[model samples]
Target: MLRYILHKLALIVPTVIGITIASFAFIRLLPGDPILAMAGQHGITPERYEILKEQYGFNQPVWVQYFDYVWGVLQGDFGISVATKRPVLTEFLTLFPATVELALVAMIIAVAMGIPAGIFAAVKRGSWFDQLTMGVALTGYSMPIFWWGLLLIIFFSGYLGWTPVSGRIALNFFLKPITGFMTIDSLLYGNWPAFVSALRYLILPSIALATIPLAVIARQTRSAMLEVLGEEYVRTARAKGLSPRRVVGLHAFRNALIPVVTTIGLQIGTLMAGAILTETIFSWPGIGKWMIDSISKRDYVVVQSGLLLIALIVMAVNLIVDVLYAVINPRIRVQ
Candidate 1:
C-alpha cells in the first residue's frame, strides 16, 4: 500500500510539469498582448511599450521566461496576478475554498440522491421508478449547463422568488472570510444568518454544477449494480437465505461501489472546471469566475498559473482516487 501510494505520488510530478509547459505555451500563444490590455484606454507610445516590456521581462526570450517561471514555481512563487497585482498563489488560495465548498456541496447532492436512485432503479429494473430515474439521468447528462442554470434561475429565482440569483452570501451579513468558504466561516463566526444565506445562495449553483455528475453517478451505479447483482456471490447470498436488503446492500452494493467511487473521484476535477460556467451564470465568486475575468483581461500570469494549479488539483484528485482503490477492495492493496 505504501509503495503503491508513493508510486502514484511520484507520477504527479511529471504530470504537473507537462501541464505547466502546455499551460505556459498556450497562455503565451493566446491573442492580445497582456501589456496593452493592462494599459487600457491609456495607450502607450512605442518607447513606453518597449520600456514596459523590459520592465515586466516580456522582452526576455520565451525559453528564459519559461525557465524563470518554472524556477519560481519550484520555490512556491506563482508570480503576481496582473489583474489584481497580488501574488497568483495568494489570489488562487483566496478564491479556491469557495470553489471547494461549492463542489463539495454539489458532490454531496449528487451522491446522496444519485446512488440511492440508482440502487432502487436497479432493484426495480422495469418499474416506473427505474424508468423515471433513468429518463431524468439521461436528460441531466444531455443538458447544457448554462441553459439549465438559466432555466433554474427563471423558475426558482425569478418566478418563484425563493433564492438569490447570485453571490456566495447576502452582502448584509459581511462575514469575514476565514476559510474562504462562506458556510464554514459563518459557523466559525457563529453567524447563523450568514450560514442560512450561504445555503440559499448555494442551492441553485450547486444543483447546476451537480447535474452532470449526478447523471453520471446514477448511470454508473445502475450499471455496476446490475453487473454485481448477477455475480455468483450475490446469488450465493440470496441462496443462503439472506434478506433481499442484505443481499443487495451488503453483497451487491459494496461490490458495485468501486466504479461509482471512481466516477465520483474523476468528476471532482470536472466539477471544479465546470464551476466556471456555473459560477459565471450565477455570479458566484470563485476561482473559476476569477479565471474567466483574468482571461478577458488577458492576464497571462493568472491564466497560466490558474491552469497549472487546476491541473495539479486534478492530478491530486486522481492520486487520491487511486489510493481509495485499496480501501474499496483489499485485492488492490494486496496487488
Candidate 2:
C-alpha cells in the first residue's frame, strides 16, 4: 500500500510540471497585453509602456520569463496581480474555502439522492420507476448548467420567493468567517438564524451545480448494481437464504461501489467546470467567479496561477480516490 501511494505521489511531479508549463504558456497566448489592461482606457505613453514591461519582466526573453515564473512558484510566490495588486496565492486561499464548501454540499446532495434512486431502479429494472428515473437523469445530464441555474432561480427565487437569488448567505446575518464555510462558521458562533440563512442561500446553487453529477452518479450506480447482482457471489448469497437487504446492501452494494467511486471521483473536474457558470449566475463568491473576473481583466498572474491551483486540487482528489480503491476492496490492496 505504501509503495502504491509513493508511486502515485511520484507521478504527480511530472503532471505538476506539465500543468505549470501549460498554465504559463496558455495565458500568455491569449490576445491582450497585461500592461495595456492595467493602463485602461486612458492608456500609457511609449516610455511608460517600456517602463512597465521592464518592471513586469515582460522585456525579458520568453525562456527567462518562464524560468523566473517557475522559480517564483517554487518559492511560493505566484506573482502580484496587476489588477488587485495582491499575491495570487493569498487571494486564491481566501476565496477557495467558498468553492470547497459549495462543491462539498453539491456532492452530498448528489450522492444522498442519486445512489438510492439508482439502487431501486436497478432492482426494478423494467418497471416504470426505472424508466422515469433514467429519463429524468438523461434530461439532467443534457441540460446546460447556465440555463438550468437561471430556470431554478426564476422558479425558486423569483416566483416562489423561497430561496435567495444570489450570494452565500443573507447580508443581514453578520457571522464572521471562522473557517470560511458559512454554515460551519454560523454554528461555531451559535448563530442559528445565520446558519438557517446560509442553508437557504445554498439550496438553489447547490442543486444547479449538482444536477449533472447527480445524473451521472445515478446512472453509474444502476449500471454497477446490475452488473454486481448478476455476479456469482450475489447469486450464492441469495441461494444461501440471506435476507434481501443483506444480500443487496452488504454483498452487492459494496462491490458495486468500486465503479461508482470512480465515477464520483471523475465528477470533480465537472463540478469545477460547472462551478464557473453556477457561481457567475448566482453571484456566489468563489474561485470560479474569481477566475472569470480575472480573465476579463486580463489578470494573467491570477488566471494562470488559479488554473494551476485548481488543477492541483482536482489531481489531489483523484489521488485520494485512487487510495480508496485499496480500502474499499481488499483484493486491490493485495494486488
Candidate 3:
C-alpha cells in the first residue's frame, strides 16, 4: 500500500508541474497584458510601462520568468494579486475553505439523497417508487445550475422570505473565521445566529450544485447495485436464510459502493471547479468567486495561482480515490 501510494504521489508531482507550466503559459498568452490590465492603459507612457514591467519582472526572458514562477512556488511565494495587490496564496487561502465547505455540503446531500434512491430503484426494479425517484433524478440532472439558483432565489428567498437572499451569512450575524468555513466556524465559536444563517444560505447553492452529480450517482449506483444484487454471493446469502435487507445492504451495497464512491469523488473535483458559476449567482466568497473576479480583472498572478490550486485539488482527489480503492479492494495492495 505504501509503495502504491508513493508511486501514485510521484506521478502527481509531474502532473502538477505540467499543469503549472500550462496555466502560467496560457494566462500570459491571453489577449491583454497584465500591466495594461492593472494600469488600465488609457494614457500610459513608455517609461511608465517599462517601469511596471521591470518591477513585476515581466521584462524577464521567458525562461527566467518560468524559473522564477516555479522557484517562487517552491518557496511558497505565489506572488501578489495583480488586481488586489494582496499575496495570492494568502488571498486564496482565506477563501478556499469556504469553497471546500460548500463542496462538502453538496457532496453530503448528493450521497444521502442519491444512494438510497438508487438502492430503492434497483431493489424494486419497476415500481412506482423507482419511477418517481428516477424521474426526479432526471429532472435534477437536466436543470441548469444558474436557472436553478435563480428559481431558488425567486421562490425561497423572494416570495417565502424564509431564507437570506444571498451571501454566506445574514447581516446581523457576527463572523468568526475559526476554520474559514462560516458554518463550522460559527458553531465552534458558539455563534448560533451565524451558524443558522450560514446553514440557511448554504442550502440553495448546495442543492443547485448537487443536481447533476446526484443524478449521475443515483444512476450509477442503481446500475452497479442491480448487477451486484444478482451476483452468486448475494444469492448465497439469500439461500443461507439471510434477510432480504441484509442480502441487499451487506452483500450487494458494499460491492456496489466501489463505483459509486468513484463517481462521488470525481463529482467532488468537478464541484470544486464548477462552483465558479454557482458562486457567482449566489455571491459566495470562495475560490470560485475569486477566480471569476481575477479573470475579469486579468489578475495574472491570482489566475495562475487559482488554476494551479484547482489542478492540485483534482489530482489530490484522484489520489485519494486511488488510495481508497486499494484500501477497500485489498487486491490492489502493494506486495
Candidate 4:
C-alpha cells in the first residue's frame, strides 16, 4: 500500500506541471496584454508600458516566462495578483474553506439520503416506495444545479424566509476565523448562534451541490443492493433463520457498500466541479467565484496558480478514492 501510495504521489508533480502549462498557455493565448490590462492604456505611452513590461519580465519570451513561473511556483511564490496585488495563494487559502465545507455537507446529505433510499428500494423492489423513490431520483438527476440553487434560494429564502439567500453566513454574528471554515470554527468555539447561522447559510448550497449526486448514489446503491440481496450468500443467511434485517443489512449491505463507496468517493470530485455553478449562483466566496473573477480580469498568475491548486486537490481526492477501494476490496491489492 505504501508503495502504491508513493507511486501515486510521484505522479502529482508532473500532473501539476501539465496543468500549469496548459493553463498558462490558455491564459497567454487569451487576447490582451497582462501589463497593459493591469496598468491601463489610458495615459500610458509605449515607453512607459515597455518599462513596466521589463520590470515584470514581460519582455522575456513566453518559454522563459513559463519556466520562471514554474520555478516561482516551486519556490512558493505564486506572484502578485493584478487585481488586488496580494499573494494569490494567500487569497485562495482564505476562500477555499467555504468551498470545502459546502462540498463536505453536500457529501453528507448525499450519503444520508441516498443510502437509505437505496436500501429500502432494493428491499421493497417493484413496490410503491421503490417507484416513488426512483422517480424522485430521476428528477434530481435531471435538474440543473444552477437552476436548482436559484429555486432553492427563491423558495427557502424569498417565499418561506427559512434560509439565507447568499453568502457563507450572517454578517452580524462575526465568528472568529479558524482554519477559515465557518462551520468548523463555529462548532469549535461552541458558538451556538454562529454555528446555527453557518449551518443555515450552508443548507441551500449543500442541497444544490448534493442533488445530482444524491440521485446517482441512490440509483447505484439500489442496483448494488439488489444484486447483493439476490446473491447465494444472502439466501443462505436467510435460510439459516437469520433475521431479515441482518440478512440484508449485515450481509447484503456490506457487500453493496463497495460500489456505494466508489460512488461517494467520485462524488467529491463532482462536488468541487459543481461548486463552480453553486458558488456563483449563491454568491459564495469560494475558489470557483475567485476563478471566475480572476479569469474575467485576466489575472494570469492567479488563474494559473489556482488551476494548479484545484487540479492538485482533485487529483489528491482521486488518489484517496483509489486507496479506499483497495482497502474495502482486498482483491485490488492482491493483483
Summarize candidate 1's per-residue lDDT along 173-289 as a digit string, tens digits.
887788888988899999898899999999999999999999999999999999999999899999999899999999999989889989999899879878999999999989999
Tens-digit per-residue lDDT, 114-211, candidate 3: 99999999999999999998898899888888899899999999999987777998888777677898988898888887888889999999988888
lDDT of 2 by residue, 1-335 (tens): 89888988999999999999999898898899999999999989999999988988899998999899889989989899989899999999999999889999999999998999899999999999999999999999999999999999999999999999999988888876789999999999998999999999899999999999999999999999999999999999999999999998999999899999999999999999999999999999999999999998888889989998899999999999999987888788677
- lDDT computed for candidate 4: 0.88
Native-to-model Cα distance after best TM-score fit, residue 239 in candidate 4, in Å: 1.2
Per-prediction CA RMSD (Å) = 1.2, 1.3, 1.8, 2.1
Candidate 3 vs. truth: CA RMSD? Answer: 1.8
Cα misplacement distance, residue 85 of candidate 1 (Å): 1.3
CA lDDT, candidate 3, residue 97: 92
**Predictions ranked by lDDT, top down?**
2, 1, 4, 3
TM-score between candidate 3 and the true structure: 0.94
On a 0 to 100 scale, what is the lDDT of residue 184 in model 3? 80
Each model's TM-score?
A: 0.97, 0.97, 0.94, 0.92
| Residue 145 accuracy (lDDT) in model 4 | 94
252: Cα error in model 1, Å: 0.6
Cα-based lDDT at residue 328, candidate 2: 86
